[model samples]
Target: MTPLKSGTQFSFDLLAGALTGRDAARATGTLHVLGNPGGRIHLRDGGVICVESPGSPGPDALLLRTGRLSESEWTAALTTGTRGTIGETELHVVAMMATHDAAFTVVAGEVEDCVFTPQTLDTAVAMSVAIDPVRLLQETSRRITSLLALPCSLSPHRDRVAPVPGADLHDLAPVREEILAHATGRRTTRDIAFAAGRSVYPVTIEACRMVTDGLMTVVAGTSVIATAAQPLVPLRPRKPPTRRPPTQMPPTQMPPAENPLPEPPEGDDGDDVPLPRSLRRQLLPKLFKQPERKKL
Candidate 1:
């Protein structure tokens, strides 16, 4: 399909138009961003269900950042092919927040290369809950304004942060203090956000202010080290491995064993008795002897 022209109309505008028309139909599909940091938005029943971008930190990171779910639990859930027992409402809220965050990050830039594809059961992610379309639109609108107001230095997933030596920390909010405390020169805004158990959006925005205020400094081209303590992203459960058919075993044959009985002692009273060959022979002989006995 020809990509949508990026003027007054955006992918979101198109989606809203389609979903809210007189037909009042539901839309389930993926919106593909075709720019440098491309992304996908999964929708269900005209509501945003999930959002993902190569350039953005996802919902899993936001979930982990809240400290509501432990690393071990998250890992086990992913490994077991289950989302665990997190409440539907909670997950929906998290998904909504992440969707807005990602959408804001990706759509704020030039979107001339964006496209949408209607998805069916074969293509869309199976989702049990979805964010309300109105709510999602509202939140996205809010974040766009918030995003535009943010400092350009506050790069969401790219910039590294470091605390200034001998900086006064008394005036900082608790969340900001937590973020600042974890800002080693080695960690990026993303890493600090993970360590502080906060979302990247707010944490990076605050970190940017700190940089401007001389409380923290930005480090160039620092790479993040993956660790058990700090999982930078959420992990999805893997599909079960395919099983192979059982191999047939070859049959084996063995010689039949012989049965043997022990012989009786010579002249023993309990010696093996001679057996009559047939019942008729023994009966006919006995009947003839009965007639002779009668004559005697």
Candidate 2:
């Protein structure tokens, strides 16, 4: 199949267009990417300070929806970024995480075109940070490469995934557990990411892995993947790794083995191999060579 021309490439081209050529590095404004899942990329000089997309949750959603920040607290923090308050540090990190996540979402889908509005990006809010455009684009490209390389090629923005019926589910991590619990046909991976308070790329990748493992499936009509008659490859259930049952040892076949864990260094007396350093020091201080007293 032909490669997607408008995914990350278009965003990179549009963004790069503003930063390249003669005297374009000083360009400052919001680049409005216009499309179904498009949003604004605010820049100053050459750095991207903010990226907002309807397709993906922003810092506000990352905080509010996840209960990480209350509306009052969010407002107070934004209003007062003083030290000892909610602080800009946490807000900065959240904004940065959301910016990258939103960028991936924007570039993962179709962007019709972008318009550069000649307006300076405002960083008065605690939730905005200056990000290098080159770095952002590189990260977006890397995310695209990783997402496409997955076994189930799915879009977080467009693919509304559903959990497989009566699928064997066991020992799921918190992320996957939340994904499984919240993945109705109505919610896209973007929605699930917002609901689960996670970055969308990993959520999308996990959904793809789940699809491949038969623990989940793309909603009947909501995926480019499902639109294809068959997936890139036939997906079958992947059994989670299981521990083998201890079998009765045959006297003829079995060899005597004492320790399952690593043995201590040879010639070391009163040493406990499995004990931690602190415990070992406490239990057997004499075994440790004392630092020789300096001659006074």
Top TM-score model: 2
Span of ten consecutive residues with least summed lDDT in model 1: 228-237
lDDT of 2 by residue, 1-296 (tens): 12232244444444444433233355677777776577777777767777887777677767776676788876776677532343567878878777777777887766666677777555433235576665666566556655655556676666778889999889987778989988988888878987877778778877878888899987776644333222221012225546655795534532322222232222212211222232223332333344333556
Per-residue lDDT value at 59 in model 2 = 76
User: Model-by-model lDDT, in order?
Assistant: 0.52, 0.62
Q: How much does each candidate deviate from the true structure in C-alpha RMSD?
A: 36.8, 19.2
What's the lDDT for residue 57 in model 1?
Answer: 62
In model 1, where do residues sit more than 4 Å from their true spots?
1-25, 65-67, 75-85, 108-112, 120-129, 132-135, 150-153, 157-159, 170-172, 185-188, 194-197, 219-296
Q: Candidate 2: where are CA atoms >4 Å away?
A: 1-12, 18-24, 65-68, 78-85, 121-129, 225-296
1-296, model 1: which lDDT tens digit per residue? 01111211243444344333333236667666665355776766666667676555666776676776667767876677455667767866776566666665554433434456775323112235766644544454444334333343354545567888898878777877787779888776656755765555566666766777888876655523322222111121225536655785444533322221233222222112221222113222332233323433
